[model samples]
Target: MVRPLAVDVDGTLTRPKPDRGVDPRVFEALRAYSEEAPVVVATGKAFPYPVALCEFVGLPIRVVAENGGVVCIEQGDGDDPYGGGRFGDGVVYNGDREAADAVARAYEAEGHALGWGAVDLVNRWRETEIAVARDQPLAPLERVAAAHGQEVVDTGYAYHVKSPDVDKDIGLETAADRLGYGPGDFLAVGDSENDAEMFGVAGESWAVANADDAALSAADFVTDAAYADGFLEALERATE
Candidate 1:
């Protein structure tokens, strides 16, 4: 059997920001891949987005949303999330929401035009830290987050200002625990700096063609293709 696989959503499964939805091949590949083992969509897209996608696409896969803040277990035929198909994973915070919010407010007050993620209740009603879309230098912002026991890291598409207490690796570990697998039992794949956290933790890691330098450096392998296509190629190699 293939080991449990954790794939990032934005850059790995889908294209970058301003682009939405998974390619049909990616969606179908996920479904086919799931038959081999647990295939989880781990992303920074809040939580509801994954739920809606799964419901809309009829995917039976589990999800790790909000950059691993929570894991929605796959439904076992009887457990439904929205009264019909499936529900999202319960909220699991990697960082303190209160602390994260405090840090976010601090940045926004300083006149940082933050673009809040509307799908996950990032600003108004979130369980962990809020994700703000920003494309700028992060050194200064990093200091701001550090001051409050929080951190702001770029996920390629945005600067996630969050609780230093939790990260994607932490969330992945949590999911592994739930699935009764060890770090060496899976392959982590992605295409950004935030995804680097999964490298050392998983048995193997792959960086898509478009992965940033840091992500590529941390990966065990680098795919020739980019985005969803790269993911499928790497997955093929891994299972071989």
Candidate 2:
């Protein structure tokens, strides 16, 4: 069987900002690959987003959402998330949402907006961790988050404030266990700092050409292309 594929969303599957959505060129290849091995779409995105992506991408709903705060692996036949599915190991949660929220509150009290503005859907469904818009001043948010016993992580798209104990690796560990595999059995690919922890755990890891410093440092290899092209390149290399 093919090794499990753990991939990021934003900059890994899609193009950078000013461009959006997973590139159509990857759809066929990704779906084909998923037929041979589980494709875990891991990201700092909220749970629903990745779940929906899995649905539309024609892959089973295996995702590490909210930067490792939420993990869902489709095992057995029950598809309802709120019903029998929650009874077993179908879903798992980590991180401290309350602590992260406190950081957001304190940061706003210091006269800084959360930066996404009102009706910010980016974080509307996020169940764990706090995602601040990347345009916000990072240093001040970092200071406020630290005071509240939280840490800030830059994923290029946003600044995530979360518990130091939680990260993508933690999420992957949960996923791997539930799927009857180990962390080292997976091949990971991504392009941001949020993916750094995951890169460190996978048996093999690739940072896209445009990856941030953290991811580049953590990954075992770096693809020659950026964005979705880099993802395709990594996928090809893995299967080759």
Candidate 3:
């Protein structure tokens, strides 16, 4: 059987630029691959984003969103699409949004804007983590997070302040169980600190060329290309 594939969004699937858009090349690649095996969208993004991405990309609705804070799989038949026949406690939530909210309040009290501006859409719908735009100062945010017993993770695209208890690997495990597999049966791919935990748990892992130090150190292989190009490279190597 083709090994299940778990991939990150943002830096791993998107172009690093003004728009940070998804590379169109990956859409076809993903759609084709999902036909043979499960394709999991694992991201630090809020829940709704990856779900929609899966729909558009023509992949299954297996998502690890909000880091490892939320896990959801589409189990309903087409007749009642998303009508709740899921597994592992049905939309498992490991994160504590209240804690993250407290951290955000403290960070703002210290004069930080969460870096996304007054109309912060990046975190508006986020259910589990406090997401701050990368432009914000890391030290102050980290300090505030630590003060509130939260940890900070840099996903390359942004800074996430969330419960240390949750990470992508945890979500992947949940996703795996629901899909009737294990972490070791999956091929993990990503490009940032948030992906480190996922790399550690997968039987094999790939860090895209643009991956941060944490992901690079944890991955079993590093692609030569960056962003979506690197992601495609990893997919090719996995087949080979």
Error of 3 at 95 (Å): 0.4
* lDDT tens digits, residue span 90-193, model 2: 56889888898899889999889878877988778888898998788899999998898889989888899989889999999999888889999999999998
Per-model CA lDDT versus the true structure: 0.74, 0.87, 0.89
Query: TM-scores of the models, in the given order?
Result: 0.85, 0.94, 0.94
Off by over 4 Å in 3: 76-88
Instruction: Indicate the TM-score of model 1.
Output: 0.85
Residue 86 displacement (Å), model 3 = 5.1
Stretches > 4 Å off in candidate 1:
16-18, 75-90, 116-125, 136-140
Which residue pairs in model 1 clash with each other? 72-89, 81-86, 81-87
Best by lDDT: 3
Model 3: lDDT to the true structure: 0.89
Per-residue lDDT tens digits of candidate 1, residues 1-240?
Answer: 687888888888886446765766777777677677777677777777776666666665466777667667664542354465343344455667677777777776777745643453445544666777676446666777899877777887778877665667877887777666886788899888777887768888999998999899999999999988899999899889
State model 2's lDDT.
0.87
lDDT of 2 at 47: 90
